[model samples]
Each structure stands twice: as structure tokens, then as C-alpha cells.
Target: MNLKDLPIDAQPREKLLARGPAALCDTELLAILLRTGTAGRGVLQMAGELLGKFKGIAGLLHASADDLKGFKGLGGSAKRAELIAVIELARRALAEQLKERTVFSSPDAVKDFLQLHLANRSHEVFAALFLDSQHRLIEMKELFRGTLTQTSVYPREVVKHALAVDAASVVLSHNHPSGSVLPSRADEAVTQTLKAALALIDVRVLDHVIVTQGASLSMAEKGLI
Candidate 1:
């Protein structure tokens, strides 16, 4: 059915006016971006079809203009215009996401800082957050990961890696698929061993954190770090 053929208040344009832009669907949102459509289709319908083909924003971001232009009614210029619009959407999404880590004072702050990025990961990931003497974050690096139950990491290796990265202080973190935030016995042993090694190198071991699906535990808060 034609967009304009719908009841005036029931149309995307009307709903947007009544309830704001958040009330709009993906297609409706894209229609706002497109402004106009080609052939007999309305912009909303074309956008709906395009969103279906591209999945959501992620899939759309991965699509090239050439691929988009191949869509039945999309011309090269139309595809290019839509792609430019999509790029802006991607930029806004990134901009609205969590800010870069600056300083990590408390364990809760560190977990809260990282949980956004870590919570959605599919596999176990070990990250080492590097810090300056002031405890301000310099950067973080993924150290290593094991399949399940264990990671074959070494304390000496941790020290070696820290030295290579020129890190003065480091915070260790790992995820648990089973949703238990408690550190395993092996985790305790490895952390202590790494602490000792890093101590010798004059690099500080700030904290070791175990993250679950919903909660996280910090060894530093428990005097483990």
C-alpha cells in the first residue's frame, strides 16, 4: 500500500511527529535519510527492502556502494547517497558509545568502564590494561585466551609481554562463560605468580578481574592484586 494512502496520523511521517523519531522503524529511519525513492516505490518501502537485505546497521555498514547499487531499483548515485548516509549513522553510533578509558581508580570503576565492551564477547578474552604512573589508562591489549577451563599462560611470559609493551603498570582481566565471577584456584595461582614476576621487573600488577555474564569480581578489592 502507498505510504500517503495510509491514514494521515498512521503514516511514518505522522508517527514521527506525534512520538518523535525514536518511534520510527529501520525502514522509516532510512526513508528519512533517503527523502525520495525511484520508480513506483516510496522511499519507506525501498528503505524497508534495503534494511531486510542488509540485516541491520552492522550488515549495512559492511555493504559497499557497488553491492547496494545492484539492488533492483537503486541507481549508482542513489546507492552512493545512501552509503554516505549510512556512514554518518555508523559514526553517530560510535560517538554515542562509551568514551575512551582515562583513569581507573576503583575496581568498580574499572569493571564499569570495560563491561560495555567485554559483556558481549563470544569467547573468553584476556585483556591487559596498561597505565601510566598516575593510573591513567594508556591502552589495553588482548593477552591470550584458552578454549575452556584453562589458559596456558605463563608468569614469565606476562612479564616479557609487559616489558615489550613498555607498560609501567598493568591490570589483568578475563571472562567466564559459566557466569561465575569468582577466580578459580588456578586463576589465583597464576595471578600471584605473575605479580611476583612483574614485581621483579618494576612493573605494577594493579588488579585481576573475573567477569561473568552479569557480575564481575575484582581481586584487588579482595587484596589479591
Candidate 2:
């Protein structure tokens, strides 16, 4: 049945307005974005079909524009743009929150920020959090992207960037797209090499965080630093 045929409380739009977005199911949320469905299908039905086809919200969000355009209900360029915009907004919001707060002082904040930025990625990424002498955030820079298992990190380049920014210390981070937060032998060796290089310029290496979708590991906490 169409949404209009359902009881007011049973409708996704009505329920959303009455309660909150957090209360809505994934299908309902997608229905709102889709707005309407084809001639015989209700918005909710279309949403369910789309979710099934994409294997869920994460798959849909990460889908390429061409992939989305191939889908019946999501073929329009406007719809594709809207979905991409929402994802970008979410990433930017997390980044902005990290910038506005004390990044290093709170371990939870750092984990949450890094998780939001790196967890959902499909490949490896190496990033740095440059902090002032007080441990306040100076800047967050994404230095490299690599294959599923490894990335080539140059300690000399990292030191150069730290000096350019006058960073007193830094939190090094990289994601394992394989979803394992355990630091490999190579990860440990590179962290040590970067630490030694940065120390030459008196820029302390505070921590090396290994990020995955499910968890993050701190090298300092593990006594690896």
C-alpha cells in the first residue's frame, strides 16, 4: 500500500515529523530521500528494494555515481548529487567538531574523530594530527593513500611537513582496510622511523593510531612508542 493508505502513525514521513530521524529505520530514511516511487510502488517499497539491491546503507553511500545512476529509482543526477552531498556533510561535520575542541587531551574525542574520518574507507590512508606545544590541534593532514595492505610512508617528508607547520608534536594515524587494528611489523617499523626522524627536529611523536571500522589501537597505550 502507498503511504497515504497507511495510518498516519505508520507513515515514514509522519513518524519522522512526530518523533525524530533517529527513530526511523534505514528504509524509512531512504524513503524520505527518494521522496516517491514508481507508478505501482510506494516510496517505502522502493526504499526496501534499493536497500536490498545495494546490500544496505553503507553500500549505497559508497556507491559510485554511475552505479547509483544504473538503479531505477536513483537514476537522476540530482538524486545522486544529493546522496553525495549528505555523505560529504557528515564527514565535514565530524572534522569541524575535532577542530573546534581539544583533540589530544581527550582520547575518546580523538578516537571518535578518526573513526568517523577513516573507518568507512575502502582503502588504506595515512594521516597526521599536528598539535601545538599545548597539545591543541594545529591541523589534520592526509599525507598518503595506498593499497589495501600497505602504504609507502617517507619519514623525511613527514618531518618536512611538521617543520613547515611548526608542529610541537604529532599523532600519526593510518587505516587498515582489512578491518584489523593490530599493527603489523611494517606499521611498527615505520612508526619508529617516523618518530626518530621527527625527533631530530624536536617534534615529538605522541602516538600512532591504527584505525579500522570496528576499533582503533594506540601504539603508546600498547607501549610500542
Candidate 3:
């Protein structure tokens, strides 16, 4: 679609002015940054190619600027700017999701909130979800990263981060890069270790969640702790 041929006042920018910004998706917003495209491609086409190259929005957000620099037209400063914008959009999305979260009402909400942010990762990251007295989410801090079976999640550090955030409780969460929701011995051990460690500080350990592609396992639900 030749955006320019649609007339100056009828372009997406113009339509957005006449309507609103929520009318666009990630690719559409990216197309706006692209502005123009190569002879055979439109802005949407190029934007789609960029997203496809990285997999999806999450993958694209996680991709490094240098890696994106390899794309023929995506090289140089303008391309880097586009890449930065894409990641910024994701950051804003996650930040917005966290805003005004006073406490977690249920296990399902926690899974829903973090699932997209973690599902695409290839490495296991132990994350601490800080919660206030009411169980609302305060912040999510990454404590450690490792392979499938060896990820070292330190309970002390998790407690420390919670204390720093003035959190009254915490939910431990991690992704199974292999797409298995089953908790291993290490996972159970870490959970018990963390539960005990948090007890010393008087901070409640709400749950330990293992997120997979299709579902999540909560230690609390499984009676693992």
C-alpha cells in the first residue's frame, strides 16, 4: 500500500489524528517509523519482515541492535533508531502492566501478567516478583540466569531485592526454556531454600511458578512446598 498515494490528509498519521492511537498494532506503529519503503515493499511489508526476522514482538524486543544491523536496509543509525523504538514499546507495555498493581489477587493473574514477557527466553531466568502487604505486585527483579537444570536462584538476593522495594511478600517465577512446566529437584530445593530464607526476614513467600509455552505450574497449587 502506497501510503502517500492515499492523499496527505488520509495517511495513517492523519487518520490517527482524526481517530486515535489505539487503532494500531506493533507492526503498524513500526510501519509509521519506517515512513517509506523500497520500491517493491510498503512500510508494513518492511516492518513485517523485521518482526519475522526476530520471530515476534517479544523476540524482537530481546534482539540486540547489532544483530538487527545485519539486515540490508535495517543497518545504519536510522535502523538502530527503529530497533530502539521497538524495544522501548515493549518496555512501556510491561511497565504499564505493572503500574497501579497494588497486590496480586490470584495465581492466575501473576501468570497472565508475566507469561508473555518470559515465554520466549532461551535461558532460564530466576525472577522475583515483589509484592506489598496486600499482595499487589511491586516490581519484578531478575536475580540470576543459567541453563535449564543449573540456574542458581539465590534466596538471599531475592529477599534483599524485596526488602529494597519494601515488599511484604514475594512470588518466585522462572521460565522453562525447554517448554516443560514440570518442576525439577533443583526447582523444589530452591523453593524450600527461598521459603526458609524469606521466613527469617519476615517476608512471606507466596508462590514459585514455572512458566512454560502452554501452561504454568505453581508450587503452591501442586503442594510442592
Candidate 4:
């Protein structure tokens, strides 16, 4: 069950060096991060257990330090810190990409940026990606929390933030903790309401994205926007 017990080429580090990182499965890659395991659990076993507990890599990466507490191999601060740091780095990398290029040029990146920010929440969150005239990201703000009914999300507030950021266009985003990225009637109604309100100020609503832990849906792509 130990790394040494495996054939050298079968070990995580050995396999990574032999065939590159893409060749390693999630467990092997995570085992390398973990380094070692508890007295009884091997690193691969511990890694598998962690992934299972969290539901997979995306769930694990988004896990908070407190969420990792009491886990066998992750009881130490170092491993937990590494995991948290990785996710933060990914978010910053995506943010940097959005800052450097037009969002429309790579729509998947925008969805990824929103997914990393909005996914894994236990409740609904209504957020906006305020963009510059060239459609590059200016800021992403979480404007409303709790249920995302039209009543709960105020278009006036969204318009105010858009003006404050000097955004010429905006992408609306929200998370469905229920794991369904399907936009409900409320989602459509609020998008239209915000679209109308922003139009009054000469701001454009570019897209409305619904995100969950593992998937995302773009209203613009669906012609719902």
C-alpha cells in the first residue's frame, strides 16, 4: 500500500516523470500532493478517500480549510494550505486572463471564471461581471445573496454598481446550489429586468450564466438573454 511497494514506474512521481502529468489519474496526482499518508492508509488510498469525500477534484479544490479538518492525511495545515492555495491561484489566473483579453473571444474562460467563483455555494448568489468598453473584465461582484427571485435582486442596485465601475457591458451570473444550471423563470425575469434597467443607463447585458459545482449554462448561448 506504500509508494515503495508499487512498481517504480507505477508510483505517482515515477509515472508523472515517465509519461507526463496528464497520464496520471486524479488519485495519483493527489497522492503526490499528499506525499504520505496516515499510519495505516497509503497515500493513494488517502487521496482516493479525500476525493470521494468531497465528490471529486473540483469539490476538493473548492473546499475550505475548515472543510478539510479531521481528514486523515489532511490533518496537517501544510496539505490543507496547499489545496486552498491551488484553488486561489486558479481563480487569479482566470481573472488575469479576463483582464488581459476580450471576454467574448473566449467564452469558455468566462464560464470557468464564473464557475470557480460561484460554484460550491449552499445557497443562491447573484453576481455580475462588469466589463470595460472593449468587453474586458473590470470587476466581478456578488450583488445579492439568498434566493435569486426578481424581488430579491434589485436592478437599481445592479445599475448603480455598473455605473460605479464604469462598465459599458455586464454579464450576469448566479449559482444554483441544487446542482442544476437550468435557468428558472425567476432567472429569466430578473435577467430581463436587469437588462432593461442597465439599458436606461446605456449599459449592455451581455449574458446571464447559471453555474453549479460541475456545470454551467449561458443564457446568451441558449437565446434566453
Best by lDDT: 4
Instruction: Look at candidate 4 and give me any clashing residue pairs.
Output: none
| Pick by lDDT: 1 or 4, better one | 4
* Model 4 per-residue lDDT tens digits across residues 74-171: 77789888888888999999999999999999999998888888888778889999999999999999999999898899988999999899999999
Off by over 4 Å in 2: 1-5, 39-41, 49-67, 147-151
Task: Write down the worst ten-residue block by lDDT for model 2.
Answer: 147-156
Candidate 3 at residue 175, lDDT?
A: 90
Question: What are the clashing pairs of model 1?
Answer: none
lDDT of 3 by residue, 108-133 (tens): 55675567567667788888788778
- TM-score to true structure, per model: 0.55, 0.81, 0.76, 0.94
What is the alpha-carbon lDDT for the whole of candidate 4? 0.91
**TM-score, predicted candidate 1 vs. hidden true structure:** 0.55
Q: On residues 102-127, what C-alpha lDDT tens digit does candidate 2 reach at each position?
A: 66657887887677677667888899
Candidate 4 lDDT score at position 64: 80
* Candidate 4 stretches greater than 4 Å from native: 1-5
Worst 10 residues of 1 by lDDT: 93-102
Cα-based lDDT at residue 225, candidate 4:
87
C-alpha RMSD values across all candidates: 7.0, 3.0, 3.6, 1.4
